[model samples]
Target: MRVAKQFTPEVLLSAPRRGPAVPSPDGSLILYTQSAHSFDDNKTLKEVRLMAVESGASEQLADDDKVHDAQWIPGTRTDIIYLKSGDKGTTQIWIADGADPAKDHYVAAEYDAPISALKVKALADGSVAFVVAGLVGPDGGLFNDKTDEKKSTGRIFDDYHVRVWNELYKAQKYALWYSTLINAHGKWGVAGELQNAIRGTTLEAPYGMYDVADPGDSFDISEKGITFIAEDTAPSSPEYSGISHVYYVPLTSFTAAPTVRPRAIVMGISETKAFYANVRFSPDGSKIAFLHSSYDSPSDVRLYMGHTSSFGAYDVHRMIFGKRPRLPPKAFEFAGDSDSLLITTEDCGRVKLSHLELRHDAEATSLVESGVVTAFYPLQEGNYERLLVTSNNIVDSSLWQIVDVSMTTQARVISSATKHGAKYGLSHGMVSEFWYEGVNDAVVHSFIIKPSNFDETKKYPWILLPHGGPVSSWLDSWSTRWNMALWAQQGYVLVAPNIAGSTGYGVDFTARIYRQWGGAPYQDLVNLMEYLKPLPYLDHSRAIVAGASYGGYMVSWMFGQDMIKKFACAIWHDGIFNLPVFMLQSDATGGGPEFGGAPFLWSNGEEMEKWNPARPELLRNWKHAPPTLIIHSEKDYRCPITEGLAAFNTLQAQGVKSRFLTFSDECHWVLNPENSMIWHQTVFEWVEKHIGGKEARNF
Candidate 1:
């Protein structure tokens, strides 16, 4: 028998991660970026790789430390573009031929300023158009920091739009620059001048509140034009009203700007009340698709599609509507023809792929139902008859497969890392789930994770993990931040509940948390505890509850109610303590309608006051609060650090045993590998101190 390696925080953090796979135009090869963190070196290593579909063999294309965002140029085989440091140490566009690198592998273009979020499209006339995000000065031109220097260290803001997320507003703002790739004497290079798409406009693409720039998710380019999302700057204060609209700019001449201003693609919803995301253009350029979630009905996200003409006019219609049981639209892509599409939805506990016809009443049928689909690519070579997919489960990290368009056939696993789980003593048998009667006669779902070692006779303590988002759910998938298996390794059973407000169930169930944060969701959690009471294998007295974001908010809510006495201890990360104050400080802008907006302007006001955990009525229960650990990051603008500080101060003032942990360098989540290790160790030690799970900290 062989001894298996212990799955520690280091092992979990350092595991290799594959970025979204991009299939080649001909579907003969697939391109993706692979990265892994190394605690020994205190750095992350990355490589761009290409895998042949027929052979399951992959080869490294680029491994330079500077390489980032590698993308395939449309309409070409093996021709790629990526970002890397130029001669002046500024990020620039670099290109190479994967099949014949020796013939062409060099710098293709260099803008004076650093740029990122590259998107490329090949035009009908053999010309290539590309867009990149870079900092722009007040004049709407590329900002040259050396030339347009700001000497003042002092800052001033006259409005609520002072800062966004972690970054304080500076003189320059992020803007998208568009230019064409010109071929001169058998050599390719970007045009001499770059046109600012939103020139003279106060709008922003990939919006300020978005921590990362995912151009692909927010924008798409077709031969006729480009469509993108930009926040409406007409509002007096961006911090109070968060709404974005999709805009289309026709592209007839690469050298000249469009005659008309970027036309907003109307989705038939109020401009000030709708939230749009995941805008995409079909491969044939005949249709467009995007998701719309209204502020009035915040939880219900509908998929809408529109036909496009040559001049960018849209005949938009609601393609899919109504309360769906297994629907949580993540992303969609047009298949075979403009008549069919592929969508990924969160079903039950899993993120499953579904096939949908373009008609309004067409129902989606599950195509890949077993595991969570992380990413998918539709092969154009087969008229969209095949798909390249990447999926994972609770025990497995990465599983890549090739599936047919028809629902009758089983998917073929082209490449998988499932066997790698055995190296860490992980098996599928360790994971299980059950459904129970919850609050409001709803059937709530919960996933159960057990220790890898076999021993059903002994009773074990369990941990309750309520997921964040209030809108999100605990999917049956692998996660590095909150690894269920690794948590179970601490000699305790782990139960993750997809409560009332969670997605994947149905629209009504998801909308239950709105304006009643501590109502039905709380009752549902209590119901789960009641359901778990009779289990012979679980010790209810030694129970622990832990959550982050909205989950953290629930912890604070639990502190106010009589439920605090049931747990040995608790952990809350970036939770909302004072609801009204959070509306004022959060980047989400007035907490939207989820907290119930006032009939008259500028405030969440008294509507949010009722649900506040720090209200005078609820404060009386803090004295009896369980010994707890509160963690907050300085850069968490979504749930500002002030919320955590307020909770900690109130708990301490109430004489409750508690400790506060702060990470100044981290954002919403502790993503740095070193910081993650410290976080895991601290959390593990705290849990052990209260619940007597001493063997949990194997590291």
Candidate 2:
């Protein structure tokens, strides 16, 4: 009577994946980061540790492979700073000091000045400035292969370039630079000679950039300078109008040569186009917080809160807008004595916690409700402002809890770190979450997992899934990918739902699936398969359903619907199947907002035509088209690989039964570990030869 284990993807690659954690403003050291999979360098291996939030003890600091911008050093307690690599692979910023890891150094004394994301602050007099985000070539080395082959001999990308996920856009911009920390008297040195300050002129070589494009956890630090979020692209205004403004620069004029120009101050109203992001700034620097998003809306995000020492004379208010969806704007921050702010989004399918107040402009309340959040902070401990969480649910994986809310609302688990993950000597599997109703009655939110040898008088077999940000959800998270506990150890019973455009359900249920792509979350997955046929344990004729990228555009819009006979088969990684050919090979930019951008038709792009599932009269509503499997990769430029070759040439010209795989050096996610064990052994051998699973692939 005791067997609970089996979940797979090789038990989510044997578990070692913790978070960005950081802590220590004198809260007794935390600094985290971990990773593990190394098999003779078939990669994963990254370290950077240092626990001890009061003796849960841990040490090892940096195996040097992505300590994803570690931090701390703000009024120290064992310094930290991170980001390594140097000579040629460029990125440097180093710093160590857990009381002498041989007193480490390198903030940039030269050595190909490439740097990337560093932000530190301290200074009221005892100095310590840092503020990075780098790149400098023609010998300062931005990956010098002779300055990347003499700046590509002639590279010229004009017409407003912006590529996404395929990477690099205008030499991937990234500017601002500075350094000061160097303290020879107390020990620990190097960081100083770097003061380029945005530019001294490479003559705008590779199109301007001073901020607002990645230095993610976007900018801040203000004793009167450095505020970030850029894009004015000056050529006489109105060039790349994805708006963005909030700029500033003053830290006592950065101590040395001609480094000033950076003043703008949170703009956007070029007659209502707008767009901005995460900004921050309130820890006594006098108030700020950001995220605006508006380009002609389908629920455009808002949340403002202003006053920034009146830099642009903003008085501002709108504490939140149209319906949530905007946290992780650099993990938000500020509770306690800044009077509440901390957030963490995606609410409903979980990953919750909220705060707001900021002297009560009200709205934004919920404070931690159930799991999936992958990291958090805002801890004043003792007199308690607590909330240092890190979540995980659906058969728990990440743990580090603690909610506390000062004189009340507690929550515990201080560290469940490394509890020997990955084992399934059989039994565990049961997640569930339910609630139905959709299309205007809304309420949605679904999920179910079941199978650890369950038996509520048997019925079983199910799959469904959907998520992929048709605005993202179906998260109660823990993943190697789409894992409802590794697909309920194969004895099926999965389902996901959160439909009607998803994203923690709000900006009009996530912009109503952008252009109603396949309308109302495919009729909320056919009213959750007619309410999972009276859930007496869900069998739905041994169902099947799979997804990826808009759930592979809803399994190629469920092969043009009639609910594709409630799925007897279907999967579609990297999918968009066709909405004007994914808005013309999308890297985002599909014309018409009266040239303001992202507009194309009727009050809603290309005029929603009964939700174009690439309409050719929706294949005469496909009499019965389920059987399919089309995964794809070969460097997916956001939904390319010609959307799994046009959903495998329309299920082989509608003769239906399909299969197409592909991977050729992956992208758009298939994170190699033997290409994710051959993508979960080709979707569990095409769900055990067509969805009636028997669990024989020895996991």
Candidate 3:
């Protein structure tokens, strides 16, 4: 028998990651993108594949080099549409046969600007209406090429949207443009000029201004009309505040703009500023549903649904359950009945799939219990009785299954992870979970990942990985950025704690981190380290801790207090080192709310200073700092590069060992495959140098 090789960063990067699967019109086949890094070429390879849903067989449908965002052409079985990148760096639409994609032909005029997020639907007039998102000039046209050729290199922003997560606001804004495919003289091509759905307005289609991934479903199109979430362009509204609304644009003709202006169908409530996302219209165009969250209660995202009308007015309300599910939903899809939904919610470290009814006192029934359901799509074959569910766990990266709508644990495996696991020598038994009482007697949960070659009698150095989202939980899912299993394979025990601020535990637990960033959650980490110190299998003295984003913020906070003494070394990436500076210079507007109101607003800078790690008192203790690795990106506007530089300088001045690693082309996270390899290698070397673990040569 062939021995399974050890899992390495190279193997991890080479592993194929699947995108959201799109089902065919008849629900007999699935179309999805599989992407992986080519170490030899040092670039990502993407392939569009077609799969037989019933048999679980798949084949490549398009050239990976040039094709992307492929979708079934609404009403046809073999007909499909996708975007193709040209040699000149322009992206255009192409139509192809699912069986013979080699004969694909371009269907529309290529625009100067690139487009993405393709949505296709069949209109009533035997024509195909397609919508794509792309940047449009200030004049609401395709693109303003003159801005690219301007002699002066300057950007004048008089308002809040000077910069977002990684890039500055340009002359163009993202808008949804639509056109129809017409068969003229038996040759398929676009009918007329693309009509801008949000034309004559300052609104942007995608409501993304803060984080990397755009907030929610920016827009969805149906046979009747198009529904989209737009950024509130009112002078009073701030992009960082995440003020957005859902608007409905009725369909007139694909060749012309909407006869009537887009109007708000869903608005925020009185007290809290609302952020909307995942705006999905029901399979039948008669109804709509989406995920809703607010500034005050960002973690308590709930599902809201309403019926659509011809007059363009709709009453969308939050579905209040008699016995609410303890977990807040992440994403949801409407059932064929249009009155029910299949929602994936984070629950106690695992994402559960639940069935929700849309009545007065409805409750979500838990369907799938094991593994995290990352995405799910309802099949039209059984009147939406069956669903295509894609999930993963700590050990397994990818698994696709077909599950019925009923409450059952059984599912037919369509894509198994057995081969992938064996290839990398991964085992499910390596993962386990434990809980302990934390601050205020609140229960804190954590996942423990052990090395594949288990030896319980031997002591292993442990790595404490705090997740990024101070508001997010470390779910039981696979992640390329920070793969726990891969980390554990480096001859160490990996302990990922879901502390007070983490979701999936409860709303109260999640909200505890608010205004008390360094209080409950910090104590929870301290208590956790203390609890783990007594365990026989762990080398408590050689403990190493690392995190990114909010996790990095916590590491910075730990350096300020007695908690820094617990770990041998630390790694902080894109963390907020100085709260006052972060509030003023960060891309986010009014960055103070997460810190409990703006400095000039509610508390007059008191709230921002209360938990700041860079406060004068905290910096005095930097003399005893541990060996540290600081990683920040130049393009990161969220935490900004200044935060990293300031922290590193303080450590250096205090005679503490520290190093700074940064990527100019990357953002808040190191997404480039080569950069990621360097990141993993550097982190491992840092840990091995101080805590004594697997050497970089062995890795």
lDDT score of model 1? 0.77
lDDT of 2: 0.63
Please give the distance, in angstroms, between residue 295's alpha carbon in candidate 2 and its true position after superposition.
20
lDDT for each residue of candidate 2 in 1-699, tens digit (9 for 90 to 100): 223355567656745777746567666667777886754556777787777776767877777674457777777667777767555555555667765554555463444545556677776766677666665554442433323545344556664444555544555444666666656766545544655554543222211233324455456776666666655443222223345555555556445533466555644355444556667777777766666655565244554555665664232333333233343222456664466676666667787767666543366676676766766775533223676678776665667766765427667666754342223432223776788887767778887877767788988778888888565677776666666766776677787888876767666667666556677788878877887787798777778888898777777777776777866777778888766556556555433232234433343444634455778767656437766778888777667788688768866886878889888878688877767877887888887787654556576
Q: Write the per-residue lDDT of candidate 3 for residues 1-699, one digit (tens) a residue.
A: 243477888878777788766677778888888888888988787888888887777888764577877877766666778888665447777777775656646555676667777777777788988888777875667773433676777888777777778877766677888988876664558888888998877788866633456433577877878888887655464524567777778877888878877877643356436677888877778766667777667777766665677323222223355355456778777766677777777888999988877777667777777778877776553256778888888877878877878745578778754453565787888889999888989899999999989799999888898888778889888888899988888888999999978988777788888787878888899889778877899988888889888888888888888878878988888988987767677776544336666544344567777888899899988777789999999999888999999989999999999999999899887888899898888988887898865455465
Residue 336, candidate 1: alpha-carbon lDDT: 57
In candidate 3, what residue range of length 10 has the lowest lDDT sum? 310-319
- On residues 181-200, what C-alpha lDDT tens digit does candidate 1 reach at each position? 86667566887677777676
Question: How do the predictions measure up, each by TM-score?
Answer: 0.93, 0.32, 0.93
lDDT of each: 0.77, 0.63, 0.77
After superposition, candidate 2 runs with Cα above 4 Å error? 1-19, 23-28, 31-54, 57-71, 78-118, 121-126, 130-396, 399-414, 417-450, 454-459, 464-483, 486-540, 544-549, 559-563, 566-616, 619-699
TM-score of 3: 0.93
Instruction: Order the candidates by lDDT, highest first.
Output: 1, 3, 2
